[model samples]
Target: MMLSGVVSAFEKVLIPVAGRISSNRYLLAMRDSFSTILPFMIVGSFFGIIEWVVIDPTGTVMGPNGMGLGMKMTGLTGEAYLASAFVATLKSLQALCNLVVTIGFGVLSLFLVAAFSYRLGGIWGGDKFSTALTGIGAFLIVTPQQVNKVGGFSLDYFGNKGVLAALLVATVSSWVFVKLTKNKKIRIHMPDTVPPAVAQSFAVLVPVLFTLGGFALFAALLTWFDIPPLNDLIYKVIQAPLMGFSQGMGFSLLYQFIIWLFWWFGIHGHNVTAAIQNTVYMPAQLANQDGTASYIFSNGFFEAGLMHIMGLVIAVFLFSKKESWRAVAKLGAPAMLFNIQEPLAFGLPIVLNPILLVPYILAPLANTFVGWLAVSSGLVPIFRFVVPWTMPLFFCGTIGTGSIMGGLLQVVWLAMDVFIYAPFVIAANRIDDEINEE
Candidate 1:
């Protein structure tokens, strides 16, 4: 009788504390932004680069073999040393591949910035490598007004160098923002109604206006004045704020649009996710020149895999509320075994929940940081192995990072999710209780 009384006393304390922790509004906001906005921005930028810089140059040619096929199929043979069909094809292929890889590197750098900013609460001081690259890229892209010209030799034309100058400028801008706002919390005020017309307007107008304005200003400055490096400065200052604003606005609007579409179709956004994965994400893996096979696990296994685990665990604990726990159990059981969570996401209504959002976002960002640290510190091998996306989290981590340490880190993420969500579940139960009472 004494032991039963003690257990009851503990439960009373535990429930309320869990409820309070789960109700943290700031954490919920952060999670919502990270989940709904960050992923889309990253993916959209990637696709933009691919469309603008990559596919424009290469058409359907994937690699050297594709180029060779074009040459052979055209039935054009010439002097091997001269501008032969093979040589032209090779040159085109090389140029295309280089452009793709370089743009990919730039996109990856941007992603790092975005990830770091989110992790650091929407602020990131530039790192040395990223900053320097951004500077060089910006200087090249933004042409300054030429001064003291001997004859007509001005370095104010847009070229490959301009792209580098733009990058550099972006880096510096990010660094400056970080330094200025490090101590302050960023206030994000999202509007309630995001109408389709408004969303579409912003989506088209924002990027176009900013990008064009940046280039035009740089060109005007170069033509009117004799400033040599003015273009670089202009580029740097413009890139960060423009990129951030455009990306943030576009992603939020796009997400809402997608949600609406899903509702109309009576389907979840999983189909969209699958299409993106199959096309954009998977094709990127094939960019590696090495003979190693490319796979879905290459890009997303660690992040998505752990989410599945966390979702399942949370679903298990929250089961008593709706008797949805049994459904969660049934679906989550197979998914958790294979490290997939589409069922949980759709079934559990975790997409827009204020409570679960925190863990959903924080867990992945935290895991990514940990994984990066481990790889950088040589605690784990750089993942070179290719595994299918369908692989379980533990095995995915092991193969993706090429170390058992990655798997261990995944476990840490799973633990974090439990801690993060347990309180949420408890809070949700309390709310349910209040509703029942009412």
Candidate 2:
């Protein structure tokens, strides 16, 4: 009874709060901005896997301590394979893959600025394409230029390190552009006889100029005071500290707990946390890929490591006596293999089920801790690739961490989760049996 009352009180507070967060326009724009670049990131990751696994001379398949797939396939000794023209051809292929990766995810902040500004501008009733262009202009205005080389722009601020600055610039510049465009006094008037494209272009011109100019002025002022570029300043002052805090085990546990807590109340916890995930964990994952940092906990860790639901599904089938439980398990089994938990989460009715809540929450928390420990202790490789959240277990781990040990680790985590859920499944069956007898 106490548990029930406590749950009710928490639900009254949490649901409304979570709903507002999930619906907030700025957060929504940020979330969608990340979503917009996900395809490109995935494509980059796919090519990156190929580069590391199949082509790169210094990578898993061909490196000094690698599996020697190249040596074996070429019918040559390890030293001979390294010297052969075939290795040169492989290097060329690797270069091509790197080229794609360099453009796709290496300059993600640029895409983030455009996507965020486009989405937010549309919401604020501005010309989206022009506003997006203006956002990019603002970003470039504040980004440091190369002083030693003519017509040269440094790409230092085009990557994940510049993400916070990108979003901030996008928000402020997009709002300014929209507000100016909406004002009759600011935007130039064009006759209806003009082609729609021409008229629209003219209408956004003044707003775009002002938006970009304001950022240019800000950058000039920073330079006059000998301050670092805005991107570097924001990263050092705000993003770096937040990222460090997010890397702590305590934060990881709280993050995992809140996800399950929201799930327990039938809220889409992942959606509620989407903005935070994009802003914090996504950059960490990119940093890991770029070799700039070694963060063990990241978006990839959640997707490829802790998102398993198959253990609970297996437990239900093995221990549940209730027909409804078995039926949901059978229906959810296929989806659970791909890490889609909704069928089991809602269909098995894990939501609000006191008996199942312990295991449902505990399973993921255990996985998060174990995964973190494994990576931090060097028992498993840190995740580097952006494996799709729906990618099947074992495979995601293997590809994401670039090691077979990663797949083996998932097997271990799966067994642990099954053990955690089994007793609870049996207890729920017993309760149902008693209820039926009554």
Off by over 4 Å in 1: 1-315, 318-322
Q: Write the per-residue lDDT of candidate 1 for residues 230-274, one digit (tens) a residue.
A: 434544454444333321334323433453333222232332233
Each prediction's Cα RMSD? 16.1, 6.5
The runs of at least 3 residues in candidate 2 whose Cα sits more than 4 Å from the true structure, single-residue gaps closed, are: 1-11, 147-151, 239-248, 251-365, 371-409, 417-438
Best by lDDT: 2
* lDDT tens digits by residue: candidate 2, 1-438: 444454446557756775676677776676667667767766775677687665777566676556767776777776687789878889999899988877776787888899999999988888899989999999888889888857667776787666768878999999999999998897787888999999998888888888888998999999999998897676556555566679898888888889787676555466445545766888889998899988898888887755456888888878878889899889988767756566677788876666666777888889988998898899999888776565678887887788988888899899998898887777776656666889
User: Candidate 2: deviation at residue 158, Å?
Assistant: 2.1
The alpha-carbon lDDT assigned to residue 362 of candidate 1 equals 51
Model 2 has a clash total of 0
After TM-score superposition, the amount by which residue 114's alpha carbon in candidate 2 deviates from its true location, in angstroms, is: 1.4
